[model samples]
Target: MPSPADKLRALLAQDKLHVMPCCFDALSARLIEQAGFGLTFMSGFAASASRIGQPDLGLMSYGEVLDQTRNIADAVRIPLLADGDTGYGNAMNVRRTVAGFAKAGAAAVMIEDQVAPKRCGHTPGKAVVAREEAFDRIRAANDAKAAGADILILARTDARHEHGLGEAIGRAAKFSELGADILFVEAPRTVQEMETICRELPGPKMANIVEGGETPDLPHKELEDLGFAIAAYPLTLMASAMKAMVHTLERLKSGQDRTADLMDFGELRERIGFNDYYEVSSRYETSRRD
Candidate 1:
C-alpha cells in the first residue's frame, strides 16, 4: 500500500483543485473520509477549541498537538496534514516537530513563520519572525524531510499581517527555494493579492478559507482558476457543528423536541465504526467455533 505522503503527493500532481475540509478530532476526520473527501487538515484553531475549549493562542503544548495528530491520522486512511505551530521552539525544535508528526502517521506537517505563542492566522496580533528565522524554520523542516522523515513540509507565512504582501511573498519564495513541498500565504485581503500569490509562488500551493476570517471564501472553481492546488475550508465543519449543537441545547432548554437537530442513531453508529467492528470481530466468536 502507498504511504500517506505518497497519496498526498499523487493528489497534488493532479492538475485540479482539491477541496479540503479541515478536521479537529478523530470523529471529524472519519466523517470527512466517509464524506468522500480526498484530503483533510487538522486545524490548530479548531483542535484547540474542541480539545481544550480554548482559543488557538499557541496554548496547546507540543505533546498535546502530536497526540491529537496520531489519533486523527490513525482514524482515517486518507492523508492528514497536521498543524505544527511555530515548530514549538527554534530551528532545532522544528526538526523534532517535523519528525514527530511523521512518526505520528501524518502525511504532512505545516511549519509556520509566526513567532512563538502564535495567534490564529485570521486573528489580530499576529507577527512573523525575522526573515532569517523564518527561513531557518523552513530549512530545518526541509532538512528533516531530507533525512527521511517521509513527510512533506508545508511552508506557511503570516508576514502579511504585520508586514506587507510583498514581504509575505518574499518569505514564501525563500521557503520554496529552501525546498518546501507546499507553500501557504496566509490572509490575502483581496482577490488581486490572492492572484499575485499564486502567480509568484511555485510548486503546490494551499489556500486557507476561514469563514468570517481574513481570507475570502471563494468557490473551489474560482480558486482552481487562480492556480491553487488545494482550497482548505478550515472552519466550515467546526462552525456548522458548533451551530447545530448550540441550537439543540437551546431547544432542549426550552422543552422542545430536539430529534430534528440530531443524526439518526443507526447512521451515527456506522459512522463511528461500530458496525464495522462487529462484522470484523465475528470471525473470533466462540459460538461460531462451537
Candidate 2:
C-alpha cells in the first residue's frame, strides 16, 4: 500500500487545489476521512484549544502534540499535515521534531518562523526570529526529511505582519531553495497579497484561511485560480464544533432535549466502529469454543 506521504504527493501532482480541513482529535480525523476529504491538517491552535482548554499561545508541549498527531494519523488513512510550532526550540530541536512527527505518522510537518512559544498567526502581538535563525530551522527540517523521514517539510513565514509582504516572500523563497516541499506565507491580509505569494513562491504554496483571520476568506475556486496548491481551513471545524457544543449545553440547561436533533445512539456507535470490535469478539469466542 502507498504511504500517506505518497498519496499526498500524488494528489499534489494533479492539477487541482487540495483542500485540507483542520482536525482537532481522532474522532474529527475519522469524520474528515469519512466525509471524503483527501487530506487533513492538525492545527496547533485547534489542538491547544481542544486538548488544554487554552489559547494558541504555544502552551502545549512537544509530547502532547506528537501524541495527538499519532492518534489522529492512526484514526484515518488520509494524509495528515501537522503544525510544529517553532519546532519547540532551535535548529537541533527542529530536527528532533521532524523525526518525531514523521514517526508519529504525519505525511507533512509544518515548521514556522516564530520565536519559541509562538503565538497564533491570527493573534496580535506576534514576533518572529532573526532571519538567520529562521533559515537554520528550515534547513534542519529539510535535512531531517532527507534523512529518511519520508515526510514533506512545510516551511511557513509569519513575517507579513512584523516585517512586510516583501520580507515574507523573500523568506519563503529562501525556504523553498533550502528544500522545503511547500511554502506557507501566513496571514496575508488581502487577495492581492495572496496572489503575489502564490505567484512568487517557488514551490507548492499553502493558503491558510482561518475564520476571522487577517487573510480574506476567498472561495476555494478563487484560491486555485491564484495558483495556491493547498487551501487550509484550519479553524473552521474547530470554531463550528465549539459553537454547536455551547448551544447544545445551553439547550440542555433549559430543560430541552436535543437528542433527537443529534445522531441516533446506534448510528453514532457504528460511526465509531463498534461493530468492528464485536466482530473481533465473536471470532475470539468461536476460537475458544472450538
Candidate 3:
C-alpha cells in the first residue's frame, strides 16, 4: 500500500486542482474520505475551536495538536496535511514539530512564517517573523525531512498581510528553493495577487479559500487555471456543520420539530461504523463458540 506521503505526491503530479475540505477531528476526516474526496487538511482553527472551544490564537499546545493529528490521520486513508503552527518555537523546535507530526502519520506538515501566537490567516493582528527567521524555519523543517522524518514540508508565508505580496512571494520562493514540497502564500487579497503567487512560485502550490476571507473564493477550475495545485476550504465544513447544529437547537428550544434537520439514526450508526463493527464481531463470536 502507498504511504500517505506517496499518495499526496501522486496527487500533486496530476495537472489539475484538487479540492481539499479541511477537517477538525477523526469523524470529520472519515466523512471527507467517505464522500470520496482525494485529500483533507486538519484545520488548526477548527481543531482549536472543537478541541478547546477557543480561538486559533495559538492556544492549543503542541502535544494537543499532535494527538488530534494522530486521530485524524488514523481515521482516514486519504492524505492528511497537518497545520504546524509557528512550529511551536524556533528553528530547532520546527525540526521537532515536523518530526512529531510525521510520526503521528501526517502526509505533510505545514510550517508558517507567522510569529509565535499566530492568528488565523483571515484574521487581523497577525505578523510574520523576520525574513531570516522565516527562512530558517523552513530550512530546519527540510532538514528534518532530509534526516528521515518521512513527511513532506508545506512552507507557508503570512507576510502578505503585513509586508507586501512581493515580500510574500520572495519568502515563498526561498522556501521552494529550500526544498519545500508545497508552497502556500496565505490570504492573497485579489485574483491577480493569487495569479502572481502561482506564477512566481514553483512546485505544488496551494490556495487557501477561507469563506469570507481576504482571498477571492474562486471556483476550482479558476484556481487551477491560476496554477494552484490544491484549493483548500478551511472553514466550509465547520461553518456548515455549526450552522445546522445551531438551527436544530433553536427548533428544539422552541418545541418545534427537528426531525427534518437531523440525520436518521440508522444512517448515523452506519456512518460511525457501528454496523461494520457488529458484522466483524459476529465472525469472532461464532468461531470462539466452535
| C-alpha positional error of residue 248 in candidate 3 after TM-score superposition, expressed in Å | 0.7
Per-residue alpha-carbon lDDT of model 3 for 1-290, expressed as tens digits? 98889999999999999999999999999999999999999999999999999999999999999999999998889999999999999989999999999999999999999989999999989999999999999999999999999899999999998889999999999999998999999999999999899888889999999988889999888998999999999899999999999999999999999999888999999999988878777778674464
- TM-score list, all predictions: 0.98, 0.96, 0.98
Model 2: per-residue Cα lDDT over 63-82, one tens digit each = 99999999999999999999
Q: Write the per-residue lDDT of candidate 1 for residues 1-290, one digit (tens) a residue.
A: 99999999999999999999999999999999999999999999999999999999999999999999999999999999999999999999999999999999999999999988999999888888999999999999989999989999999999998899999999999999998999999999989999999999999999999988878888889999999999999889999999999999999999999998789999999999988977877888773464
* Better structure of 2 and 3 per TM-score: 3
Give the runs in model 2 whose Cα sits over 4 Å from its true position.
Answer: 286-290
Could you tell me the lDDT of residue 168 within candidate 3?
Answer: 94
- Alpha-carbon lDDT, every model: 0.94, 0.91, 0.94
Q: Give the Å shift of residue 124 in candidate 2.
A: 0.5
- Measured by TM-score, how close is model 3 to the native structure? 0.98
Native RMSD of candidate 1 (Å): 1.5
Mark the regions of model 3 whose C-alpha exceeds 4 Å error after superposition.
286-290
